[model samples]
Target: MNIDISKEDFELAPGESVLIHTNEFIKVPNTLSACIYERYSVKSLGLMISPAHYMNPGYKGNIGLLAVNHSTVPIKLIPGIKICQLALFELTSEPLRPYEKQGGKYMDAKSASISKLHLDAEIQEFLKSKGVQKASDDMAKELGEYLMGHIRASAKRLADILRAEEESQKNG
Candidate 1:
Protein backbone atom coordinates (compact mmCIF):
# COMPACT_ATOMS: atom_id res chain seq x y z
CA MET A 1 0.00 0.00 0.00
CA ASN A 2 1.25 3.47 -0.82
CA ILE A 3 1.81 5.69 2.20
CA ASP A 4 0.89 9.29 1.65
CA ILE A 5 3.66 11.03 3.50
CA SER A 6 2.45 14.44 2.53
CA LYS A 7 0.26 14.95 5.57
CA GLU A 8 2.19 13.20 8.31
CA ASP A 9 5.30 11.20 9.03
CA PHE A 10 5.29 7.45 8.65
CA GLU A 11 6.59 5.15 11.33
CA LEU A 12 8.37 2.10 10.02
CA ALA A 13 8.51 -0.75 12.47
CA PRO A 14 11.59 -2.81 13.17
CA GLY A 15 12.11 -5.71 10.80
CA GLU A 16 9.72 -4.06 8.38
CA SER A 17 10.30 -3.34 4.76
CA VAL A 18 8.21 -0.86 2.81
CA LEU A 19 8.11 0.64 -0.64
CA ILE A 20 8.67 4.37 -0.42
CA HIS A 21 9.03 7.12 -2.96
CA THR A 22 10.55 10.53 -3.41
CA ASN A 23 7.73 13.01 -3.72
CA GLU A 24 9.54 14.92 -6.41
CA PHE A 25 8.53 14.40 -10.00
CA ILE A 26 11.47 13.79 -12.32
CA LYS A 27 12.09 13.55 -16.02
CA VAL A 28 15.00 11.72 -17.53
CA PRO A 29 16.32 12.82 -20.89
CA ASN A 30 16.37 10.39 -23.78
CA THR A 31 20.17 10.48 -23.77
CA LEU A 32 20.55 9.78 -20.06
CA SER A 33 19.53 7.14 -17.51
CA ALA A 34 19.63 7.07 -13.75
CA CYS A 35 20.27 4.73 -10.82
CA ILE A 36 19.05 4.95 -7.23
CA TYR A 37 21.22 4.49 -4.19
CA GLU A 38 20.56 4.55 -0.46
CA ARG A 39 22.06 7.63 1.10
CA TYR A 40 24.73 6.77 3.66
CA SER A 41 22.93 8.83 6.26
CA VAL A 42 19.73 6.92 5.72
CA LYS A 43 21.59 3.63 5.59
CA SER A 44 23.17 4.44 8.92
CA LEU A 45 19.69 4.62 10.41
CA GLY A 46 19.28 0.90 9.66
CA LEU A 47 17.19 1.47 6.58
CA MET A 48 18.43 -0.37 3.53
CA ILE A 49 17.19 0.38 0.03
CA SER A 50 17.26 -2.72 -2.09
CA PRO A 51 17.91 -2.82 -5.79
CA ALA A 52 16.11 -2.71 -9.12
CA HIS A 53 17.98 0.56 -9.06
CA TYR A 54 18.18 1.23 -12.74
CA MET A 55 16.04 4.16 -13.83
CA ASN A 56 15.99 3.97 -17.59
CA PRO A 57 16.32 6.77 -20.08
CA GLY A 58 13.01 8.53 -20.66
CA TYR A 59 11.61 7.44 -17.35
CA LYS A 60 9.37 10.14 -15.94
CA GLY A 61 8.24 9.33 -12.45
CA ASN A 62 8.99 9.84 -8.82
CA ILE A 63 11.81 7.60 -7.59
CA GLY A 64 10.71 4.53 -5.67
CA LEU A 65 12.60 2.74 -2.95
CA LEU A 66 12.29 -0.56 -1.17
CA ALA A 67 13.20 0.47 2.32
CA VAL A 68 13.81 -2.01 5.16
CA ASN A 69 14.18 -1.10 8.77
CA HIS A 70 16.92 -3.34 10.16
CA SER A 71 17.28 -1.80 13.57
CA THR A 72 15.45 -3.04 16.64
CA VAL A 73 13.50 0.16 17.03
CA PRO A 74 10.93 1.88 14.90
CA ILE A 75 12.09 4.62 12.57
CA LYS A 76 10.16 7.79 11.92
CA LEU A 77 10.39 8.75 8.28
CA ILE A 78 9.51 12.29 7.40
CA PRO A 79 8.39 13.65 4.08
CA GLY A 80 11.01 15.17 1.82
CA ILE A 81 13.70 13.29 3.73
CA LYS A 82 16.87 12.61 1.79
CA ILE A 83 16.58 8.86 1.90
CA CYS A 84 18.19 7.95 -1.39
CA GLN A 85 20.59 9.30 -3.97
CA LEU A 86 20.23 9.35 -7.72
CA ALA A 87 23.12 8.99 -10.13
CA LEU A 88 22.53 9.67 -13.81
CA PHE A 89 24.48 8.00 -16.56
CA GLU A 90 24.92 9.48 -20.01
CA LEU A 91 24.22 6.52 -22.21
CA THR A 92 26.37 6.00 -25.27
CA SER A 93 23.09 5.71 -27.13
CA GLU A 94 19.52 5.59 -26.02
CA PRO A 95 17.95 2.18 -25.81
CA LEU A 96 16.28 0.91 -28.96
CA ARG A 97 13.21 0.95 -26.74
CA PRO A 98 13.15 3.48 -23.96
CA TYR A 99 11.41 2.93 -20.62
CA GLU A 100 8.08 4.21 -21.88
CA LYS A 101 8.42 2.77 -25.35
CA GLN A 102 9.35 -0.66 -24.02
CA GLY A 103 6.21 -0.94 -21.87
CA GLY A 104 7.91 -0.23 -18.58
CA LYS A 105 4.86 0.10 -16.33
CA TYR A 106 6.65 2.45 -14.00
CA MET A 107 6.97 5.27 -16.43
CA ASP A 108 5.16 8.26 -14.96
CA ALA A 109 3.98 6.03 -12.14
CA LYS A 110 3.32 7.43 -8.70
CA SER A 111 5.57 6.83 -5.73
CA ALA A 112 4.97 3.39 -4.18
CA SER A 113 2.67 2.44 -6.99
CA ILE A 114 1.69 -1.18 -6.74
CA SER A 115 3.64 -3.53 -8.97
CA LYS A 116 2.57 -3.45 -12.59
CA LEU A 117 4.33 -6.67 -13.48
CA HIS A 118 1.04 -7.90 -14.86
CA LEU A 119 1.06 -5.05 -17.35
CA ASP A 120 4.36 -6.10 -18.88
CA ALA A 121 3.92 -6.70 -22.58
CA GLU A 122 5.22 -10.24 -22.62
CA ILE A 123 3.20 -11.21 -19.58
CA GLN A 124 0.10 -9.73 -21.10
CA GLU A 125 0.72 -11.66 -24.29
CA PHE A 126 1.08 -14.91 -22.42
CA LEU A 127 -2.06 -14.25 -20.42
CA LYS A 128 -3.96 -13.47 -23.59
CA SER A 129 -2.74 -16.68 -25.19
CA LYS A 130 -3.91 -18.70 -22.23
CA GLY A 131 -7.21 -16.81 -21.92
CA VAL A 132 -6.29 -16.27 -18.30
CA GLN A 133 -6.17 -12.97 -16.49
CA LYS A 134 -5.49 -13.08 -12.79
CA ALA A 135 -4.02 -10.63 -10.38
CA SER A 136 -0.80 -11.84 -8.77
CA ASP A 137 -1.83 -9.77 -5.79
CA ASP A 138 -3.66 -12.53 -3.90
CA MET A 139 -0.60 -14.72 -3.53
CA ALA A 140 1.75 -11.80 -3.03
CA LYS A 141 -0.43 -10.20 -0.39
CA GLU A 142 -0.79 -13.45 1.51
CA LEU A 143 2.94 -13.99 1.46
CA GLY A 144 3.63 -10.46 2.63
CA GLU A 145 1.20 -10.85 5.50
CA TYR A 146 2.69 -14.17 6.52
CA LEU A 147 6.22 -12.86 6.45
CA MET A 148 5.36 -9.73 8.33
CA GLY A 149 3.66 -11.79 11.01
CA HIS A 150 6.75 -13.93 11.37
CA ILE A 151 8.99 -10.88 11.56
CA ARG A 152 6.85 -9.14 14.15
CA ALA A 153 6.76 -12.25 16.27
CA SER A 154 10.50 -12.69 16.09
CA ALA A 155 11.08 -9.07 17.02
CA LYS A 156 8.76 -9.36 19.97
CA ARG A 157 10.54 -12.44 21.19
CA LEU A 158 13.88 -10.71 20.95
CA ALA A 159 12.57 -7.71 22.82
CA ASP A 160 11.18 -9.91 25.56
CA ILE A 161 14.50 -11.66 25.95
CA LEU A 162 16.31 -8.36 26.19
CA ARG A 163 13.89 -7.03 28.74
CA ALA A 164 14.29 -10.14 30.85
CA GLU A 165 18.03 -9.71 30.76
CA GLU A 166 17.76 -6.13 31.83
CA GLU A 167 15.48 -7.03 34.73
CA SER A 168 17.80 -9.79 35.85
CA GLN A 169 20.77 -7.47 35.74
CA LYS A 170 19.01 -4.83 37.79
CA ASN A 171 17.86 -7.33 40.40
CA GLY A 172 21.27 -8.98 40.67
Candidate 2:
Protein backbone atom coordinates (compact mmCIF):
# COMPACT_ATOMS: atom_id res chain seq x y z
CA MET A 1 0.00 0.00 0.00
CA ASN A 2 1.04 3.61 -0.47
CA ILE A 3 2.26 5.57 2.60
CA ASP A 4 1.86 9.19 3.56
CA ILE A 5 2.81 11.19 6.66
CA SER A 6 0.34 13.55 8.22
CA LYS A 7 0.83 15.55 11.44
CA GLU A 8 0.79 12.44 13.60
CA ASP A 9 4.09 11.06 14.86
CA PHE A 10 5.25 7.72 16.30
CA GLU A 11 7.46 6.47 19.09
CA LEU A 12 9.79 3.52 18.74
CA ALA A 13 10.67 1.06 21.49
CA PRO A 14 14.19 -0.29 21.76
CA GLY A 15 13.98 -2.38 18.61
CA GLU A 16 10.94 -0.81 17.04
CA SER A 17 10.78 1.42 13.95
CA VAL A 18 8.21 3.28 11.86
CA LEU A 19 8.10 5.41 8.76
CA ILE A 20 8.64 9.13 9.46
CA HIS A 21 8.63 12.38 7.53
CA THR A 22 11.62 14.04 5.96
CA ASN A 23 9.59 17.30 6.42
CA GLU A 24 9.88 17.98 2.75
CA PHE A 25 7.28 19.00 0.19
CA ILE A 26 8.32 18.73 -3.43
CA LYS A 27 6.29 20.99 -5.65
CA VAL A 28 6.68 22.65 -9.01
CA PRO A 29 8.50 25.62 -7.55
CA ASN A 30 10.74 23.77 -5.09
CA THR A 31 12.51 20.40 -5.10
CA LEU A 32 13.27 18.37 -1.99
CA SER A 33 16.86 17.43 -1.33
CA ALA A 34 17.53 14.43 0.87
CA CYS A 35 20.95 13.48 2.12
CA ILE A 36 21.48 9.77 2.58
CA TYR A 37 23.78 9.72 5.54
CA GLU A 38 25.26 6.98 7.71
CA ARG A 39 23.21 7.84 10.82
CA TYR A 40 20.11 9.54 12.20
CA SER A 41 20.71 13.26 12.63
CA VAL A 42 18.25 14.04 15.42
CA LYS A 43 17.95 11.48 18.23
CA SER A 44 21.26 9.80 17.73
CA LEU A 45 22.67 13.16 16.67
CA GLY A 46 26.26 12.06 16.33
CA LEU A 47 25.38 8.50 15.42
CA MET A 48 25.43 7.42 11.80
CA ILE A 49 22.36 6.60 9.64
CA SER A 50 23.14 3.68 7.43
CA PRO A 51 22.75 2.27 3.96
CA ALA A 52 20.96 3.96 1.06
CA HIS A 53 18.44 6.45 2.44
CA TYR A 54 16.82 8.32 -0.46
CA MET A 55 13.89 10.42 -1.71
CA ASN A 56 12.44 10.21 -5.20
CA PRO A 57 11.56 13.13 -7.46
CA GLY A 58 7.88 14.16 -7.28
CA TYR A 59 7.78 12.36 -3.93
CA LYS A 60 5.42 14.01 -1.48
CA GLY A 61 4.85 11.96 1.63
CA ASN A 62 6.37 11.05 4.95
CA ILE A 63 9.74 9.91 3.65
CA GLY A 64 10.22 6.29 4.63
CA LEU A 65 13.62 5.48 6.10
CA LEU A 66 14.65 2.27 7.80
CA ALA A 67 16.03 3.19 11.26
CA VAL A 68 17.09 -0.10 12.80
CA ASN A 69 18.79 0.16 16.20
CA HIS A 70 22.46 -0.68 15.89
CA SER A 71 23.31 -0.25 19.55
CA THR A 72 23.65 -3.09 22.02
CA VAL A 73 21.62 -1.08 24.51
CA PRO A 74 17.97 -0.14 24.16
CA ILE A 75 16.94 3.16 22.54
CA LYS A 76 13.69 5.09 22.31
CA LEU A 77 12.29 7.01 19.31
CA ILE A 78 9.44 9.49 19.43
CA PRO A 79 7.23 10.88 16.70
CA GLY A 80 8.02 14.26 15.06
CA ILE A 81 11.48 13.62 16.32
CA LYS A 82 13.95 14.94 13.82
CA ILE A 83 15.39 11.57 12.96
CA CYS A 84 16.80 13.38 9.98
CA GLN A 85 16.70 16.73 8.32
CA LEU A 86 15.98 17.12 4.62
CA ALA A 87 17.90 19.81 2.79
CA LEU A 88 15.86 21.47 0.04
CA PHE A 89 17.29 22.36 -3.31
CA GLU A 90 16.17 23.98 -6.56
CA LEU A 91 17.03 21.50 -9.27
CA THR A 92 17.70 23.07 -12.65
CA SER A 93 15.14 20.59 -13.96
CA GLU A 94 13.17 17.58 -12.76
CA PRO A 95 15.13 14.35 -12.82
CA LEU A 96 14.53 11.85 -15.66
CA ARG A 97 13.81 8.90 -13.37
CA PRO A 98 12.10 9.48 -10.04
CA TYR A 99 13.70 8.11 -6.88
CA GLU A 100 11.09 5.40 -6.34
CA LYS A 101 11.45 4.14 -9.89
CA GLN A 102 15.24 3.93 -9.62
CA GLY A 103 14.80 0.20 -9.07
CA GLY A 104 16.90 -0.26 -5.94
CA LYS A 105 16.35 -2.92 -3.28
CA TYR A 106 15.22 -0.33 -0.67
CA MET A 107 12.60 1.39 -2.78
CA ASP A 108 9.97 1.80 -0.05
CA ALA A 109 11.41 0.84 3.31
CA LYS A 110 9.56 2.53 6.17
CA SER A 111 11.52 1.43 9.20
CA ALA A 112 14.86 0.30 10.53
CA SER A 113 16.12 -3.07 9.28
CA ILE A 114 18.80 -5.71 9.43
CA SER A 115 21.41 -6.28 6.76
CA LYS A 116 20.08 -7.74 3.53
CA LEU A 117 23.58 -8.96 2.74
CA HIS A 118 23.86 -12.61 1.94
CA LEU A 119 25.37 -14.96 4.48
CA ASP A 120 26.72 -18.42 3.78
CA ALA A 121 25.23 -21.62 5.19
CA GLU A 122 28.47 -22.35 7.01
CA ILE A 123 28.35 -19.05 8.86
CA GLN A 124 24.70 -19.55 9.69
CA GLU A 125 25.48 -22.99 11.06
CA PHE A 126 28.32 -21.63 13.14
CA LEU A 127 26.17 -18.86 14.55
CA LYS A 128 23.40 -21.33 15.24
CA SER A 129 25.82 -23.60 17.06
CA LYS A 130 26.78 -20.71 19.31
CA GLY A 131 23.10 -20.53 20.31
CA VAL A 132 21.25 -17.68 21.93
CA GLN A 133 22.00 -18.99 25.43
CA LYS A 134 25.58 -20.12 24.93
CA ALA A 135 27.30 -17.43 22.97
CA SER A 136 30.78 -16.74 24.34
CA ASP A 137 32.47 -13.33 24.49
CA ASP A 138 34.58 -14.18 21.47
CA MET A 139 31.57 -15.34 19.54
CA ALA A 140 29.73 -12.12 20.32
CA LYS A 141 32.67 -10.04 19.24
CA GLU A 142 33.07 -12.01 16.05
CA LEU A 143 29.39 -11.63 15.25
CA GLY A 144 29.58 -7.90 15.75
CA GLU A 145 32.49 -7.70 13.36
CA TYR A 146 30.64 -9.84 10.87
CA LEU A 147 27.70 -7.48 11.00
CA MET A 148 30.00 -4.52 10.44
CA GLY A 149 31.47 -6.21 7.42
CA HIS A 150 28.03 -6.60 5.95
CA ILE A 151 27.19 -2.94 6.57
CA ARG A 152 30.42 -1.82 4.95
CA ALA A 153 29.79 -3.90 1.88
CA SER A 154 26.22 -2.66 1.62
CA ALA A 155 27.38 0.92 1.98
CA LYS A 156 29.76 0.43 -0.91
CA ARG A 157 27.05 -1.00 -3.08
CA LEU A 158 24.77 1.91 -2.22
CA ALA A 159 27.50 4.36 -3.07
CA ASP A 160 27.81 2.75 -6.47
CA ILE A 161 24.10 3.07 -7.04
CA LEU A 162 24.01 6.71 -5.95
CA ARG A 163 26.94 7.49 -8.21
CA ALA A 164 25.21 5.92 -11.16
CA GLU A 165 21.95 7.66 -10.38
CA GLU A 166 23.70 10.97 -10.12
CA GLU A 167 25.37 10.37 -13.46
CA SER A 168 22.10 9.40 -15.08
CA GLN A 169 20.42 12.59 -13.85
CA LYS A 170 23.36 14.63 -15.10
CA ASN A 171 23.37 13.05 -18.55
CA GLY A 172 19.65 13.58 -19.05
Candidate 3:
Protein backbone atom coordinates (compact mmCIF):
# COMPACT_ATOMS: atom_id res chain seq x y z
CA MET A 1 0.00 0.00 0.00
CA ASN A 2 2.66 2.43 -0.95
CA ILE A 3 0.63 5.49 -1.83
CA ASP A 4 2.73 7.80 -3.94
CA ILE A 5 0.97 10.93 -2.75
CA SER A 6 3.94 12.87 -3.99
CA LYS A 7 3.29 11.78 -7.56
CA GLU A 8 -0.45 12.36 -7.33
CA ASP A 9 -1.94 13.83 -4.18
CA PHE A 10 -5.03 11.95 -3.08
CA GLU A 11 -8.01 14.27 -3.28
CA LEU A 12 -10.72 14.16 -0.67
CA ALA A 13 -13.95 16.01 -1.03
CA PRO A 14 -15.77 17.47 1.93
CA GLY A 15 -17.11 14.75 4.21
CA GLU A 16 -15.26 12.09 2.20
CA SER A 17 -13.12 9.43 3.80
CA VAL A 18 -10.14 7.34 2.78
CA LEU A 19 -7.79 4.82 4.33
CA ILE A 20 -4.15 5.67 3.72
CA HIS A 21 -1.04 3.79 4.68
CA THR A 22 2.00 5.41 6.25
CA ASN A 23 5.08 5.91 4.13
CA GLU A 24 7.19 4.40 6.89
CA PHE A 25 7.03 0.93 8.38
CA ILE A 26 6.81 0.69 12.15
CA LYS A 27 7.82 -2.04 14.56
CA VAL A 28 6.79 -2.00 18.20
CA PRO A 29 8.73 -4.05 20.72
CA ASN A 30 7.12 -6.34 23.27
CA THR A 31 7.69 -3.73 25.99
CA LEU A 32 6.43 -0.72 24.07
CA SER A 33 3.22 0.61 22.47
CA ALA A 34 2.62 3.54 20.18
CA CYS A 35 -0.04 6.23 20.01
CA ILE A 36 -0.88 7.85 16.68
CA TYR A 37 -1.84 11.49 16.40
CA GLU A 38 -2.78 13.67 13.47
CA ARG A 39 -0.09 16.25 12.87
CA TYR A 40 -1.22 19.61 14.24
CA SER A 41 -0.74 21.22 10.88
CA VAL A 42 -2.70 18.49 9.14
CA LYS A 43 -5.56 18.86 11.62
CA SER A 44 -5.63 22.58 10.90
CA LEU A 45 -6.51 21.65 7.33
CA GLY A 46 -9.75 20.11 8.65
CA LEU A 47 -8.64 16.52 8.08
CA MET A 48 -9.09 14.17 10.99
CA ILE A 49 -7.36 10.84 11.46
CA SER A 50 -9.46 7.97 12.74
CA PRO A 51 -9.87 7.74 16.49
CA ALA A 52 -8.50 4.18 16.58
CA HIS A 53 -4.93 5.38 17.00
CA TYR A 54 -3.38 3.02 19.54
CA MET A 55 -0.81 0.49 18.33
CA ASN A 56 -0.33 -2.44 20.63
CA PRO A 57 3.06 -3.80 21.59
CA GLY A 58 4.83 -6.14 19.13
CA TYR A 59 3.02 -4.70 16.15
CA LYS A 60 5.09 -4.69 12.96
CA GLY A 61 3.65 -3.01 9.91
CA ASN A 62 2.96 0.18 8.07
CA ILE A 63 0.30 2.06 10.01
CA GLY A 64 -3.05 2.54 8.32
CA LEU A 65 -4.95 5.78 8.76
CA LEU A 66 -8.65 6.32 8.21
CA ALA A 67 -8.86 9.99 7.40
CA VAL A 68 -11.94 12.13 6.92
CA ASN A 69 -12.09 15.56 5.40
CA HIS A 70 -14.19 17.83 7.59
CA SER A 71 -13.65 21.01 5.68
CA THR A 72 -16.15 22.65 3.38
CA VAL A 73 -13.79 22.23 0.45
CA PRO A 74 -11.63 19.46 -0.94
CA ILE A 75 -8.20 18.73 0.48
CA LYS A 76 -5.13 17.13 -1.04
CA LEU A 77 -3.15 14.42 0.70
CA ILE A 78 0.45 14.66 -0.40
CA PRO A 79 2.31 11.38 -0.24
CA GLY A 80 5.43 11.40 1.97
CA ILE A 81 3.94 14.29 3.95
CA LYS A 82 3.96 13.77 7.67
CA ILE A 83 0.22 13.71 8.15
CA CYS A 84 0.42 11.85 11.45
CA GLN A 85 2.86 11.57 14.32
CA LEU A 86 3.50 8.53 16.45
CA ALA A 87 4.58 8.60 20.10
CA LEU A 88 6.09 5.46 21.57
CA PHE A 89 5.99 4.58 25.27
CA GLU A 90 7.69 1.80 27.15
CA LEU A 91 5.50 -0.42 29.31
CA THR A 92 6.37 -1.11 32.97
CA SER A 93 6.87 -4.77 32.08
CA GLU A 94 6.83 -6.86 28.96
CA PRO A 95 3.50 -8.52 28.31
CA LEU A 96 3.25 -12.29 28.59
CA ARG A 97 1.63 -12.32 25.16
CA PRO A 98 2.44 -9.70 22.58
CA TYR A 99 0.33 -8.65 19.58
CA GLU A 100 2.12 -10.93 17.14
CA LYS A 101 1.34 -13.93 19.31
CA GLN A 102 -2.31 -12.95 19.84
CA GLY A 103 -3.46 -14.04 16.34
CA GLY A 104 -4.88 -10.63 15.66
CA LYS A 105 -6.33 -10.00 12.19
CA TYR A 106 -4.15 -6.99 11.42
CA MET A 107 -0.80 -8.26 12.60
CA ASP A 108 1.96 -7.72 10.07
CA ALA A 109 -0.46 -5.98 7.72
CA LYS A 110 1.36 -4.26 4.89
CA SER A 111 -1.43 -2.06 3.60
CA ALA A 112 -4.63 -0.31 4.59
CA SER A 113 -7.14 -2.86 5.84
CA ILE A 114 -10.83 -2.96 6.42
CA SER A 115 -12.01 -4.04 9.86
CA LYS A 116 -11.94 -7.78 10.56
CA LEU A 117 -14.04 -7.54 13.70
CA HIS A 118 -16.50 -10.14 12.41
CA LEU A 119 -13.69 -12.63 12.14
CA ASP A 120 -12.74 -12.39 15.83
CA ALA A 121 -12.94 -15.80 17.47
CA GLU A 122 -14.39 -14.52 20.74
CA ILE A 123 -17.21 -12.75 18.97
CA GLN A 124 -17.89 -15.79 16.82
CA GLU A 125 -18.03 -18.00 19.88
CA PHE A 126 -20.44 -15.66 21.59
CA LEU A 127 -22.66 -15.59 18.54
CA LYS A 128 -22.64 -19.36 18.26
CA SER A 129 -23.48 -19.78 21.92
CA LYS A 130 -26.44 -17.42 21.57
CA GLY A 131 -27.64 -19.14 18.32
CA VAL A 132 -27.12 -15.90 16.46
CA GLN A 133 -26.01 -16.66 12.95
CA LYS A 134 -25.46 -13.04 12.07
CA ALA A 135 -26.19 -9.53 13.18
CA SER A 136 -29.65 -8.19 12.39
CA ASP A 137 -30.90 -4.69 11.70
CA ASP A 138 -33.64 -5.21 14.25
CA MET A 139 -31.10 -6.04 16.89
CA ALA A 140 -29.19 -2.88 16.13
CA LYS A 141 -32.34 -0.78 16.31
CA GLU A 142 -33.32 -2.31 19.62
CA LEU A 143 -29.88 -1.69 21.07
CA GLY A 144 -29.92 1.90 19.87
CA GLU A 145 -33.30 2.50 21.41
CA TYR A 146 -32.26 0.94 24.70
CA LEU A 147 -29.14 3.13 24.88
CA MET A 148 -31.08 6.26 23.92
CA GLY A 149 -33.58 5.65 26.71
CA HIS A 150 -30.81 5.45 29.26
CA ILE A 151 -29.22 8.60 27.91
CA ARG A 152 -32.51 10.49 28.11
CA ALA A 153 -33.08 9.35 31.66
CA SER A 154 -29.56 10.39 32.69
CA ALA A 155 -29.98 13.79 31.06
CA LYS A 156 -33.26 14.37 32.83
CA ARG A 157 -31.77 13.43 36.20
CA LEU A 158 -28.84 15.82 35.64
CA ALA A 159 -31.18 18.61 34.65
CA ASP A 160 -33.29 18.07 37.76
CA ILE A 161 -30.24 18.12 40.01
CA LEU A 162 -28.99 21.34 38.41
CA ARG A 163 -32.40 22.98 38.83
CA ALA A 164 -32.51 21.99 42.50
CA GLU A 165 -29.02 23.41 43.07
CA GLU A 166 -29.97 26.67 41.37
CA GLU A 167 -33.04 27.02 43.59
CA SER A 168 -31.02 26.21 46.72
CA GLN A 169 -28.49 28.91 45.83
CA LYS A 170 -31.23 31.47 45.25
CA ASN A 171 -32.83 30.69 48.64
CA GLY A 172 -29.51 30.73 50.47
The numbered model that scores best in TM-score is 1
Candidate 1 residue-wise lDDT, 1-172, digit = tens: 5557777679999888888777778899989988888888888889898754788889998777788999999998887677777898998986898778976768786666556666666877887789866546565467567888998899899999999999999999
Task: Count the clashes in each prediction.
Answer: 0, 9, 1
Which regions of candidate 2 deviate over 4 angstroms? 1-33, 36-52, 96-172
List, residue by residue over 40-152, the lDDT tens digit for candidate 2. 44435333344555555555443446555554455555544455544556677767766555553344544433343224345556767776434454665577679878987
- Write down the lDDT that model 2 would get: 0.51
Error (Å) of candidate 2 at residue 136 is 42
Cα lDDT for residue 30, candidate 1: 89
Residue 156, model 2, lDDT: 86
Q: Candidate 3 residues 1-172, lDDT tens each?
A: 3456767667889877878888788999999999899988989989999865888899988888899999999998876667888899999999899999988667877877656665677877888789987645456556656886898799889989999999999999
Q: What lDDT is reached at residue 120 by model 3?
A: 72
What local lDDT score does residue 80 receive in model 2, on the 0 to 100 scale? 48
The candidate with the higher lDDT, 2 or 3, is 3
Instruction: Pick the winner on TM-score between candidates 1 and 2.
Output: 1
Clash count, candidate 1: 0
